[model samples]
Target: MKIVVVSDTHIPKRAQRLPSRLLHELRSADQIIHAGDWQSLEVYEQLKQYAPVNGVFGNTDNEDIIRVFPDKKIVNVNGFKIGIIHGHGKKMTTVKRAFTAFNQPIDCIVFGHSHIPYLKYKNKTLMFNPGSATDKRKAPFYSFGILTMSDELHAQHIFFKSK
Candidate 1:
């Protein structure tokens, strides 16, 4: 499976549209997973054009988005369980918060907020933050994530200087 992961696309608040690089990657996606902070449902609609879309709602999302998604969720793709969350909280690091969001076993965790691309293993679970496709913040470039699965699940970040 080819999973295109993205988050913190603050939409018109950040970039006027999804980055071309991200859209390009989406073309080959078997599925798309969005972590959160999507400012508009139009973004969701656009993504669905490429593949099946699944996501968790973020702190910045309004009721409209929240109504369509959950604050946190777990999805099973190709027999691997993946936890999804938008890492925004009053205390603790975003990574720590995401790690604790799920009580059951999962193969990976996908989160956004703080807009920093990260790919690391926590015990057996791979934690991934695709960063901000639209808002890179202090980061050098805009970024997103891709996960490919066959015998095992592998994840990596796709970074670009322009969004």
Candidate 2:
């Protein structure tokens, strides 16, 4: 399966729409995952046009988004267990917090909040943050991610200049 991962789109608050490059990836994806900070249900609706969207609600999301999605979720793809969270709160780093959000072992953890792209392994779990598709924050370029899963899991970050 091919999964396109994105986060912190911020929609009309950060950009009027998703970057063309990101949209292209979405169009070809088998599934889509948004970590959080979508800012509007419209963003989810737009993404749904491309593929099935699995997401969490971030701190900036409204009640409507919260009602539709939860703060954390776990999904199984091909034989891998993936945990998804927005990763926003006080104290601990987002990565550390994501590691503890789930009770059981997971093959990968997908999270977003700081708008900085991250992909790393801790203990045996893969931690992935696709950064901000629209709001790159301090990052030099806008980014998103792609995950290919079959017998093994592979992931890569795709970056491009913000328009």
In candidate 2, stretches whose alpha carbon ends up further than 4 angstroms from where it belongs are: none
| Candidate 1, poorest ten consecutive residues by summed lDDT | 10-19
For candidate 1, lDDT tens digit of each residue in 53-140?
9998898888889989999999998899999999899789999999988999989999998799999999888999999888988999
The lDDT of each candidate is 0.93, 0.93
Tens-digit lDDT string for candidate 2 (36-111):
8999999999999999999999999999999999999999999999999999999899999988899999999999
- lDDT (Cα, 0-100) at 35 in candidate 1: 98
Clashing pairs in 1: none
* TM-score for all models, in order of appearance: 0.98, 0.98
All models, RMSD in angstroms: 0.7, 0.7
